[model samples]
Target chain A: MTELALAIENLSFAYGAKKALDDVSFDVRPGECTILLGPNGAGKSTLFSLITHLYDSRQGRIALCGFDIKKQSLKALARLGVVFQQTTLDPDLSVTQNLRYHAALHGIGRKAADNRIQEELERLNMFERRGEKVRQLNGGHRRRVEIARALLHRPSLLLLDEPTVGLDVPSRQAIVEHVHALVKEQNLAVLWATHLIDEIAADDSLVVLHRGQIKAKGKLDYVLQTTGANDAGEVFNKLTEGHKG
Target chain B: MRLLHYWRAMMGIVGRELLRFLHQRERFISALVRPLVWLFVFAAGFRAALGVAISPPYETYILYEVYITPGLIGMILLFNGMQSSLSMVYDREMGSMRMLMVCPLPRWFLLGSKLIAGTAVGVLQSYAFLGIAWAYDIQAPLMGYVWILPALVLVGMMLGALGLLLSSLIRQLENFAGVMNFVIFPLFFMSTALYPLWKIKESSEILHTLAHYNPFSQAVELIRFALYEQFNLDALIFTALSFFVFMSAAIFGYNPSKGMMVRKGGGAP
Candidate 1:
């Protein structure tokens, strides 16, 4: 009976007359990584926007650790960290400077922010690159900096929207392993949106979204069993069959 | 504790802005060069063409450069404001603005801090222009420099807020160039920045009325009076009121459900 790290109920969103997310409901629990599997046109990004309060919808309720996103946004958002699909770092600023700015936004003191910055950067093997401007970092190093920045405040829930989309195999593998370790060791809840089936771990929870609707939702094995799919890719194709994503 | 958090957030935003300003040496140079061109070249040419009647802020007959000094300061604020907003639109397009918007703070406070940060940079540019003008011998009363700080900050915030409002309305970065041509030019040319209201009135009644009421005109007069160690209540009130309206509209325009974000498909995802 632990409180859910993130809870969404009956969430719906539309752009003009076209629906983006239709009556979606889900929950993410602490210490688990929920892989939100969807294609390009699916409502994965829309759902992420709602949970992060980047967009508001009258059709649903979203709560973070028991606090409503709209009514108690400061409290709700304080418990959340995000690495958006786009690189949000100030390229002109050094890695440490970017992290410090984020930590200040969360109200972490200077000294404590520095300590956390070092710890997270070191965990991501980016401590040595702290003094370098973000523009100087390669794509992989920048992604690692972003991951480290997202964790500086130590939020219970981390929302990563396709964080590994353009990264190379090695960089992608490194980030995937690091995030899985975070879920296990820090009990951090993660709602990661991606179309890549390879990113789905065996123990991960799965939500298959296609054309703004949830087609399947459960543990990876359970979803594979229910869909009668041999693997994650087959599960995705089975759920989103005949639809142009 | 909450106050400390707010303070830290403000410092972070402002520090980042200053750092960015320092890194862009070209931006600093351009900000100064535009006003200096008007001072050294345009004012010298216009000094003979335009004769000043004793104005409230001018105790005696003054050279054209001295008369236009405050107007040029207004120029610096105006351009800096637009440039900052231009960067805002760019930031939105590039997704850095999304990072800022998602901060765990009240939306108004966050926007206000951005306005303050842009204003801080604008004020610095203004003072740098003033220092260069001092070297050029277009000096104001010593205390006028001190008095102008508050005036510059107020006017800078007002213009910066207008830029913020425009940034929210401008969905694409490409459309911003047109806005600059339309908004910045009309605001600059129609105001008292280049010519006196009376001089404008002599040419066209409608143009005169427009210049008389332009918020940029009031802003110029505000800085003009402060530079002479005087105060203009009318300009102060007008500029302050304009700031409130523009800032409120900007805050509304950034609202998730009600504003441009929802219309633009939740803005920069």
Candidate 2:
């Protein structure tokens, strides 16, 4: 059996008595990319928020690499990396400064931070622009910098919340292919969140969230075949349109 | 390694905050000019109506302008702190604050770095104002500055913490200006900056009592005491207490699941 990278069991959350995530549960395995597939208002953001410890779940627990999120947050968080749904960087600082600051936050020292920054910048093909301020970079390069910053600490589990939402086809595809290769090469567990169907890899596991509940989940081919659909989007629509197992 | 990390984080944060002020030159010029106007123009008229004397911190005869240096320093801190808090709200509105939350760093470290950066700007402005004071011959003893640096730092930190605490509570930037209006002016007018507490007492015992209880009075007094090279124990206690209170409130306001995060569950427009 694969090592469990993330385990969320009986998780429930609310906003002022309104349910955002209800009785949600799923596991993402090590060395694999698991896509969280959902439509709008399907509790994807809310679930992402809980996994990130942005909001504590009202019930159940989230374990990252077997570390409970609530009880051992820093240690658990230390082993995890994330690119938020929105960009969170100082526009005034140079690309190098932003990455360096992020490195320090993860307890990475100057020598290691510099070393890792160099390695990642080269990997992202962004070394030439290191000295440029963030506001000066175009959207695609800026997003690349964010991705590079997230990988600075070599986290075992990487969370990308709607990573390709606003990107053009080539840019989105680049991120999609890059993450796929990174997961296999590094033995990293990735929770890739997106509403777009085409981003889902046939080999990747899939979880379908609908209106705050997991309507379908498991192997991408199996789930798609069970719904008698050619693609995940059709399966998603069928699940939302009152079709039940 | 850890120290190096903090140093880098602090440097990054301070660099960003400073750059923000640099890009907005008009605002800084206006901020600096306001206090100078209060000194040269407003105080000029008020100086004749009052008797200036050698205070506890002053060694000999001094002009009214020289006497109010500490109070003016307090103004720098107070305004900077409020501006920092106001920007915190603005960052949330612009989605920048949300971005910072995802970094693997300790939340307090992030907050602390921002405070240090804001404090740094306050100190820089204080020094510039000090330079202007010297240029105009409103000079304190040259040695008076050694104490001034630490005083500016302490006062900046206290006010930065206050701003951070206020930022988390004041969810909307629209709500800030009105509250700050009520807060800043009263604190400045009631403090020992313009006149000694005793003078306010001579004018009205009730005003003296009000000023005595004002935490801002304590902050201004702390700076005043430091500027004169005499540490006031009461000022120290008051400053320490205010720091604790504001810091505690800030801690409460920023508690991830309980405070601002939960309050923002609906995701305001």
Candidate 3:
């Protein structure tokens, strides 16, 4: 219970002359949703890449469930479940096949994999659609299948990168609610990246990322109080308005 | 216990390739049609122009189809390799590749598994082409069929690794078509795939030297020997070396430390 699901320290990444992330540090503990709020080009994707070891961090370190990403990448990655901003499902494959394939990748046995797949699909309320191809599903339902796939491995940390990007308003609200429910139900740590102010609840942990730096980080109320703002919308404006010029 | 996971991962990759192959029916048709066209149309046209002498692997004068069958097999593998690489580029852009890399396997193992999967498809395409050729009464020794399996696999790995290396270097799908022309034509025409090195030597010394050194020629010769149940140690060694070198280059090009040099897509995982 004392262990953080994810920990990053002084992580930085550069692409040629451009610095994408600089000295960014944070921790995501179990059973909480940490909303990483940032606008476009604010390095949210870059940070996720580094965290997932898409690109190696030259100047800092990252650990997942106490496993170092650079030195112990397999162990670190084993504890992580990720859904990219873009839909990663195979359009020709049925939902159960996709989930089973993911479970195989995680080294889960056939019997255990099938059990977990059934459990996850039922939890996500998509068990009836398990036999349908991914192409047959709507965007919102597809996202739900991806969520079910991510949970098949029982990962401690679940990372969602702008998951609700192209979904409708109701779909977006429902996904946020579903993920919130997951945190309470499974004790999973989630770092959900989004620019939508409405997604950040007053009690949620919040981190405002601007210009590749963490401008503010704390509980929503604490961040609002520290910035002398009335709400998250105002606080975001106050923290990022200076960089627009 | 860990071995079970590796086996599952390998099967998963191979199963996915087969599934994709089935979905894209055009790919399978085109893969077979290209080699069959060469065997029927191109070989018939060249039969009158090119003369065959009794080579070591050949006991009697053979028809043009018999002479170039191994070369056509190599062509199928070459195209399949590039096609697999094209899909890799597409997958990288579409984000499924990131999902693959995030699995708790070593990066080399992941890449190797992908190469093996692609090679399996290439080998299958070659056998299909062989089966079609059999319908025309062109048959190898029955024992040669079994012996040719390993040679086809080796050639497949060599060509597929070459494709993987190219995919790592070439980022954009729009730019890949041009690369196919540069790579496939030069490899096919300059090698012993179309004409023997001896014939090229008779035409031009420079072309002869190039064909002598071409790894594709070595691969074609390897298959040609295996078709007759003969062994060529030199061809085997050269192909094994090419596989190692090309696979190493691919692994390096996809390395995370050298991010900017490869994978132009942003924020890849």
Candidate 4:
């Protein structure tokens, strides 16, 4: 009965003669964490680009919180937050400064932005380091600041594109746990793209994308049952058979 | 409320540029140094070789440094424009530009804000160069300093918009060096920035025509006239038209559906 946080229908994209994404369709609901599982070069980033409106495709329709991305981009984008695979934070800026910039981009006032920055940083156990430049922080702390920036506006949906790729295990684990907690506590919708199976919680949703197509999608157990696989890794391997990287 | 959002976003972008400019002392120094070198060394050497007839911007016979001061100001705007473009390319490669592009505002507004921000920096550098020129005894009319501000903003936006257009066309950071050599040098050398259009005509009519039509020439003329509290209708129209053209092209080039974004698969190659 609740509105979907994100919806993509019949999405297709191509780079000249090569197809990047083909007829991909999926949905993410509030209070859910949807893990997009794919190997390298499996069109995961392409999908993120489309949903974020970084790339446009004529053959598809994408909606964020009931607003079409093409027709109402401002409203649609206002409901979305993203942390790209590469670090988008200004390295020379302090953590708070970076967050304030993002908050300003979203039209948050200074006072409200400060409060939100503190709340997000404190939640991530990064409040004590807000004054440090992002360049001075280790990889883990930088990612935490990025996460805080992404949540500064408190969007209805969050899209993270391989956010944990270069991070160590503990940092990776901390982000995974924090995002899961956010979903549960705030009823936020999250579509996180990553190849790491260990990041998938038992009750989370799964969408296995392979070679630009959605191979299997649903609850974790549903995907396992449909693919006849024993676990998340098995499901991924089965769905993307012969294309393993 | 909506207007407030747009105002805040512009302030944020401009403030960030100012902060970045402040932090990069080398960039500031180099921006000033480039023009200062041309004024102190290059102009001094050419003073004997070049004599100025009474031009509209020059009421009486002038020293070469005084004549070339406006051109040097143009040089500052031109180089700052290219430098801003280079940074845009770098930001694209480093992924910071994507953050700006994804903001919940119209694409034209965002690009325009960037153009405005770059122009602000360019204008700052222009004023700094003018200050140094003043101390060096090459002074303009007192009110000329104030009049030149609007002219500098217009020309800076025109040059900065051109830079934005180039950034969209350039696919990689490595390719930008070619732009500097091929684009920047030709624009600087062929324009009246260094030589008067009449002097250029004495040598080659073709080169004179090219220099006459160069937007950079119009920009320099605009600044020169403004510094003397004079108005140049021709330069005003040409520079404004050029700004519109370059800015529109840049906005189109950054469009997600049809621009370089589609060709590059949404980000730097």
lDDT of 1: 0.91
- Using all chains and alpha carbons, the TM-scores for the candidates as numbered come to 0.99, 0.91, 0.97, 0.99
Residue-by-residue lDDT tens digits, candidate 4, A86-154: 998998778888898999899999999999999999999999999988899988888889888988988
Best by DockQ: 1
Local error of candidate 4 at residue B4 (angstroms)? 0.3
Q: Is the docking of candidate 3 incorrect, acceptable, medium or high quality?
A: medium
Q: Local error of candidate 3 at B2, Å? A: 2.0
DockQ of each: 0.72, 0.38, 0.65, 0.69
Residue B215 accuracy (lDDT) in model 3:
87
Q: So what's the TM-score on candidate 1? A: 0.99
**Candidate lDDT (C-alpha), each:** 0.91, 0.80, 0.88, 0.91
The residue-by-residue lDDT of candidate 1 on A163-215, one tens digit each, is 99888999999999999999999999999999998999999999999999999
Candidate 4, residues B121-208, lDDT tens digits: the string is 9999999899999999999999999999999999999999999999999878999998899888888899988888998999999999
lDDT of 3 by residue, B7-73 (tens): 8988888888888888888999999999899999999899988988888688999888899999999
Candidate number that wins on DockQ, 3 or 4: 4
* True lDDT of residue A26, candidate 3: 88
Identify the superior model by lDDT, candidate 1 or candidate 4: 1
* Residues forming the 10-long window of minimal summed lDDT in candidate 3 chain B: B260-269
- Candidate 4 scores a chain A TM-score of 0.98
